[model samples]
Target: MKQKTIYLIRHGETDYNRQGVVQGSGVDSDLNAMGQAQALAFYQAYQHIPFSKVYTSKLRRTRQSVQCFIEAGIPHESYEGLNEISWGAREGKMPNNFDNEYYSTLIKNWAAGHTDYPTEDGESPDQVAQRQKPVIDLLLSRADENPILICMHGRAIRILLSWLMDESLATMDMYEHSNLCLYKLQYDYDTRRFTIEVANDSTHLLALVMHH
Candidate 1:
C-alpha cells in the first residue's frame, strides 16, 4: 500500500510566547530573535528533503517562521483554515485569577468528553478540529504519493493532530511542541490509518541554542 507523509511544523516562538501570554488569532506577531534562529535551523535541516508542497497559516508568526524555507526556494501556500483559534477577549491579556480556574474547568470538561465547552469568547477544541479538518483533508487527498510540509500554530496543530489520529484533545495536549519543531506522519491509503513517524524533533535547533 502507498503511504502519504505529512510533516507538521510548529511556528517559531513569538514575543507573546516569550512573555507567557495567551496570544490567539486576535493578534498577529512576528517571530522573536530566538524564533528567527530556530526557523533558519529548521530550513537547514530539511533543505535536502524533496517536499511536494509547503503550507502555512495566514498568521504572521507562522509565515515568518517558515520564511527561511521559502527563501531557500521551496514552493509554499497559505490558508486561513490553518490559523490558530481565536482567544477573543483574552487575546493579549494575562490571565486573571479566575481566568486560570475557568480555563482549567474547560480543559476538564473537554477531557470528560465535552467538546462543546468553549471559552467566553474563544473557540473550543472541537471547533478548531472542524475548521482544520477540511484543509488537512484537501492536502491529504491531493498528495497521496508526495510528502507535504505544514507550518502552523501550536494550538491549531494540536487540534489537527487529534482529529487526524482519532485521539482526544486532552491526549494530544500531553505532547509538547517547541519552536520550529518537526513532526512527521505517514498515512496509509488502504487502511486509512495515520502513523506518526516523528514527533517534536528539535535536534536541528540544538547547535543554535547552544551557541546563543
Candidate 2:
C-alpha cells in the first residue's frame, strides 16, 4: 500500500478581504501586504517538504499566495476549476448593513435545500461543486509518494473537502478556513481512502502575527 500526501491551503487575504468586501471569482483581487507576509510565512514553514507539484486557481490571490514557491522554481499549474464561487452583484461590494443582511438571507436560503438557487447572477453551490470535479479527479489519480500542494479560495476549499469526504456541500460551513491555514490529507492507494492528517491549521503563522 502506497501513501500519497496532499497539502491544501486557502489563499491569503486580499485588500477586499481586509476591507470587508465580497471577492468572488469575478473580482480577481491580488494579495495585500499582510497577505504577502502570510504567504512568505507559510513558505518558510513548509519549504522543507519536497512538493512534487503545485496547483492553484486561475485567480491572482491563489497564485500570489504561493508566489514565493513559484519564484523559487517550483513547478505549478493553474486550473479554473479551483476558482472561487461567484457572488454576482455582490462580487466587489463592500458590505453595508443592507448587503450584510441580504448576504445572510441568501446563505440561509442556500442552506435550506436551495443549493441550486442563485443570488442575483451568482453561482450556486452546485455549480461550484461541478467545477471542482476535475481537481478532485486529478488528486485521486496521482501515484503514491507524490506530494502535491494546492492553493485556492476559502469556499472552494470547503467544497473540495466536502466532495472528498462524500459529505453534503451544505455542511461545508462547518469548516473554518483562516488565511494561510492548511489542511493535510493522506491517501492510501490500497484502501482507496483519504485520511485527514491536519485541518484548519495555522500554527505556522504564529510568529508572523507580530509583524502584522
Candidate 3:
C-alpha cells in the first residue's frame, strides 16, 4: 500500500500578527523578526528529513516561514486555495470592542455548526472548503511528492485538518494551533484514510527567545 506523510505547519508570526491585526487572504504581509527566528528553529530541528516537496499558501508569510527548506533545494509551490480565510472589510483592522464583539459573535456562530456563515464580503467555511478540495485532491494524487512539507495560516490549517480528519467543520477549533505549530499526518492511498501522527505540536519553538 502506498502511503504519504505530510508535515503541515502554520506560518510564522508577522508584524500584523504581533499587533493583533487581522491579515486574511487579502493581506499579503511579511514575517517579522521573531517569526524568522522561529522558522530557523524549525528548520534547524527538522532539516535532515527527506522532504520531497514544499507546499505553501500563496501568502508571503507562509513562504517565508519555510524559506529555509526551499533554499535547501526542495521543490516548492504555492496555491491560492491554501490561503487564509478572507475577513473582507476587516482584513487590516486591529481589535477594538466593536470588532472584538463581531469576532466573538462570528466565533460563536461557527461553534454552533454554522459553517456556512461568512464575514461580510468574505468567504464561508464551506466556500473555503470547496476551493481547497481540488487542490488537496490534486496534491494527494501526485505520487512523486511524498512526505511533502506544507506551510499555511491558522484558520486555514484548522479547516483543512477538520476535513482531513473526517470531522465536521464545526470541530475544527479542536485542532488548536499557534505560529509555527505543526500537525503531522499520514495518508494511506489504498484505504483512502488519513491518520494524525501529531497535533498542534510546537516543541521546536521552546527555546525561541522573542526579542522585541
Q: Which residue pairs in model 2 clash with each other?
A: none
Report the lDDT of model 1 for residue 201: 92
Off by over 4 Å in 3: 209-212
* Candidate 1 per-residue C-alpha lDDT over 1-212 given as tens digits, one digit per residue, 9 for 90 to 100: 88888888999988889987878888898898889888888888887888878899998988888787787777889998899888777788877888788778877887787867776788887888888888878887885437888999887877778878888776657657888888899988899889888998999999996896
TM-score of each: 0.93, 0.94, 0.97
Rank by lDDT (best first): 3, 2, 1
lDDT by residue (1-212, candidate 3, tens digit) is 89999999999999999999999999999999989999999999999999999999999999999999999999999999999999888998888999999988988898899999998789888888888999899889897788899999999888999998888999888889999999999999999999999998999998875433
Instruction: In angstroms, give how far residue 24 of model 3 lies from its true place.
Output: 0.5
Candidate 1: segments with Cα more than 4 A from true spot: none
Clash counts per candidate, in order, are 0, 0, 0
By summed lDDT, the worst window of 10 consecutive residues in model 2 runs over 136-145
Error of 3 at 3 (Å): 0.9
C-alpha RMSD by candidate, in order? 1.5, 1.5, 1.3
TM-score attained by model 2:
0.94
Whole-model lDDT, model 1? 0.83
Candidate number with the higher lDDT (2 or 3): 3
